[model samples]
Target: MQDRTILRTPLCDMLGCELPVLLAGMGGVARWELAAAVAQAGGFAMLGMVREDPALIEAEVTALRAATDRRFAVNLIPAATDPLLLDAQIGRCLDLGVDTFTFFWDVIPAVVRRIKQAGGLVLHQVGSAGAARMAEEAGADVLIAQGVEAGGHVHGRSGAFALAETLLAEAGVPVVVSGGISTGRGLAAALAAGAQGVQCGTAFLATAESFAHDYHKARVVAARGEETVLTDVFVLNWPMGAAVRVIGNSVTQGLGNRLLGHDPARLPREVIAEDGGTALMRFSTDSPMRHTTGNLEAMALYAGQGVGAIRDIVPAAQRLHLMADEAAACLARAAGSRA
Candidate 1:
């Protein structure tokens, strides 16, 4: 396989595309427009189907279907509180004739079966190699190794680099790497580590199509290496999983004090819903007004170390194009040295 001309992947062949690189599904951020842009640009993109209403998803899916007749997937970040919501979302998406689905949170076997019945592909995300193997055994066609350096809630994994390397030989499925992957160089490194492609999140969130608030996009563009903090900081205000990454905010700042055996449940009750209402999601240009409010220092501002790779706000199409081009160049360089 290494000797083959680095072209579209088995996946791209499956999707009939020209590139293997994908835009990682950013919750709330992977809107229809952005998803279409990436797929149209020849990379598979996925819709972040967390916490979105059925009507909203329908409209977006319809729009995407019209925008570009390319293959893209939809993500369902499983959580308990709104597990039913996921069922509903999946039904609606399948109704829209969507065949590609990605599973996160906890994988649902029934859903996987349903997708397979529809002739769709299932890509599962994992934090470690063992989990990747499990996903493969569970009928997943691909494994996304998410490292600790990734943004959003670290629901599945703890170490990105280790997970990537571990999956190299152990995973029977085609492997993709996520977490802190923000550039063409990172893409090259991931492929060198035995990845078939790369999934980038923070890098996409900084693009012009990203629905992040003006301030949020600016923050990403202006971020330095140490600007991000990973902890259960947003967990207090939100009922999200125990692990998450966000800009160091008051909730995280107070974690040390609360860590000394003081029950966070004993602490004050200022926040309301803890379910998916406040879960960390990527911002999209088409997001509801709820996401537009620049309520920094409180809301979830998920980012990654790759924020430094972002400098300017460009179109999503342009961004995916450049990443693919750079990845091709990098792969060519590696292939040339093999002889």
Candidate 2:
């Protein structure tokens, strides 16, 4: 638990856990079972708590609290300026009594200050050196360098390689590299490229405990190269100009055709109630809920190039355990000799 192994990255030290692995905070796809399983597996799993109803988050976290006595994290989306919803999420999470939290999207100093003052550990997520610098100044315990290759909404133009290298060269805090990590080779590669640890998303998306819809899960299984496109088709439904990468389908692919290139914020926004409904079911274990179902043709299929690496559906614990085991052995054997 305390050696110079790949798992002993700064994340392990920051979270006070044994392993440096963190599960993807895929909303809807991120479920209670998966989070708990990861924590139980000796790594940390983050609960994606961006758009769900206040009650749903409360229920899930309450269950998570009962399940794992180990260290875990709750991820929040802050790109939008939804005061009511954001406050509700912070309130619920605080009520659940979680210690560590990962803040996604814009850097809100007040949230960071408030959380710190309240004794909660906040890890600010950013996409560029500018973002990372802002997070460090904001007092983030850790900075997650989420590259363009990562799933969900990306806030930085900097790729994983450059952002990570740049951050490590100057930043004072620990930098965890996220986006497109799948193979043990990827983990080895990221570390060799100057990352303290790698955060895996697409790999865990194929797991069993994930609440992603059956149809959505199948799409992940059936996807091929270049199926993904970056647009605000769905994000247009959001309040701001949030650009997310997803598989280009009918409703989604047409967004680009609809315009010759314009501002995303200019597009129409979806009703919060409907948008909330869609997100909740997109990752339902049994069936695709609102978020997963309605967007099927052009749904937000947030994925990375690592999609090709996912071969089978397995349990959450087994997934993290296997990745750790593989990364360790892979690093050891690779480090042994290059000849």
Candidate 3:
């Protein structure tokens, strides 16, 4: 069973899902289990397929297919190295029957052409209206306007709703607002402002199927609106420039700009490992995984402003259903008010 009440939007119809809510393709966090759970719950789920091994990516996709027949998207992080790596990944994904994709960072013309040729739907995550226009011209099917308040590596300085408003007026394709959005009220506000849907990342981090560590999840649950800091303090995993929003940990509080002085830490170095032996970076773009060892408390706890509203870890389906029902009721009340 999907959402008990269907709240239809262009995003839901375009994605063939019952609700307009989409699980942001969080690297390492949105694994097969979480993605499958969200998809099964009537929300469109996306797997972060950017930095995974080829075999592992294929295996994850196969596992998700085995779990649910629902269509989900794979998010690609463009590589600066050999284009062959990305081509191989895309080919493997197409072979596995995946049709939708989301791209972050720069837009690769060849990739856009290839996916379009294969009849795949392309959604681009852009921080600004300029990038949105560029992706639309490059044949992107949807645009995710991510605001600065979003967790992880957020690109733009503008807020999500503000970015969405500009994109909706000009981007031409469907626009989904991301960042600082977790509640039905947020969803209604996005829709009321002309957005097609909302892409939630931090909210799903508290779900039972999420791979986030208990300690990390607890931090998110306890976080207030002012507790998160968007900084470049954690730079062990990715490049040095990107700014990510994280809960104020000791590491973030003590080290102001020290990450700028340190080089990106080498992965597979056995610094930290989450439950089930999943290795994590010293300051990972992904959140802390379960049963993690080695400086767990000091490690980066990625979350968004919406963490204020998250209280407990629940099933992803139940969260989606409740949010959908709430959004439906909110929209109904809003319409009646205008009447």
Candidate 4:
């Protein structure tokens, strides 16, 4: 990788990281090990706690603190959580000395105020310019312009590049482009497009430290750009009616072109593996978590369009370093070409 200095941007300064890359805090995928690895690698790592138990969240935060002193952030989905549960989790984080947070779905004014009053930074994830303005008005310190190609429950209507450009023009805060970014060129492209940094989920899901099953990782590696589709069929229990990007699997194949139909309850719930089994919940966005058994291929394999760029499951730190180097090289080559 080029000198870490070469890849530094305003986002790096604000987040106190060495590089302008962020590992997306994907609820089940971006766990303690993966977040710590990326943070340790000089890039900002974010832990996803949208569906996490309060105790689990506390334990994970303690574990990451034990692993690295570098700055990291946590993600919360307001729509998916009850007010009491959300407050408990956030309180636990604050008590543990965590200050950086990212909010998905909708911005919670109370939560934002709590974090800020405690001297924390808040990042609000938005899918459009209007949402960006709303988030900025809500006092978000940073903005994550999420695009349509993002994995999990994507709420954006435009592509990442276009959304980033739009958000930069209207939102008076540093913008981090999310969705469909995986390679060094992707990082360079986001920077060139006027973004402070890029937040990547699919790329990190393929990392060695990720908690996704090995079979799921392999599926991500072998997937093509076109193999992914957006659908709301998986939201059996937590049906927000939002379309999620996922690689084609038995479940998706059965759903076909319809975005919403058929009851998820009719589908198989118990996955019997070689050892213990796991139950697939309706309306739950949990990816095949680590140690998940039984018909794993039938579960939601959440991934972005960048799945095509993933070929191997390397350590999170190694992947971040390589991406930084490749982005620096790409920008250098582009500059030379223009000259």
Per-prediction TM-score to the true structure, in the order listed: 0.85, 0.86, 0.91, 0.93
Residue pairs of candidate 3 with colliding backbone atoms: 275-290
lDDT-based ranking, best first? Answer: 4, 3, 2, 1
**1 or 4, which is superior by TM-score?**
4
lDDT of 3 by residue, 1-339 (tens): 324343678778789897889999887788999999999988999997766777888999999999999889998877332467777888888988789998887667678878999999999999999888888888999999999889888778899988888998897789999999888888878877888889999999889999878888888888896888887756655665667888888867776655334445432244554545666655656556665576787677888898898888899988888788778778788778999
Best by lDDT: 4
For candidate 4, write residues 1-339 as lDDT tens digits.
475575678888899998999888888788899999999988998998876778999989989989999999999887778778888888888988888999887666777788888999998888888778777877899999999989878887799889999888887789999999889989999988889999999999998999888988999999998899888777754545667899988767775577565455554464334323446553346567778766677667899998898899999888888889999998888878999
- Can you write out model 1's per-residue Cα lDDT over 1-339, one digit (the tens) per residue? 122236466656765567667777776788887788788877788887666787888988888888988888888765532767777888898888888888875556666777777778898887766667667776888888888788776655466767777787687778888888777778777767767887888887877776556666776778874777766534543343456666655555666544223333544544422233543332211222224433354566778877778898888878777776676688888778996
**Which run of 10 residues does model 1 get worst, by summed lDDT?**
281-290
Give candidate 4 misplaced runs (Cα > 4 Å).
Answer: 261-278
Q: What is candidate 4's CA lDDT for residue 327?
A: 92
Clashing pairs in 4: 235-283, 236-282, 236-283, 237-282, 237-283, 238-283, 272-294, 273-294
Cα lDDT, all candidates = 0.70, 0.70, 0.82, 0.83
- Candidate 2 error regions (>4 Å): 1-6, 255-295
Q: Which model is ahead, 2 or 4, in terms of lDDT?
A: 4
lDDT of 4: 0.83
Using lDDT as the yardstick, the better of models 1 and 4 is: 4
| Lowest-sum lDDT 10-residue window in model 3 | 259-268
lDDT of 4 at 242: 61
For candidate 2, the per-residue lDDT at 157 reads: 66
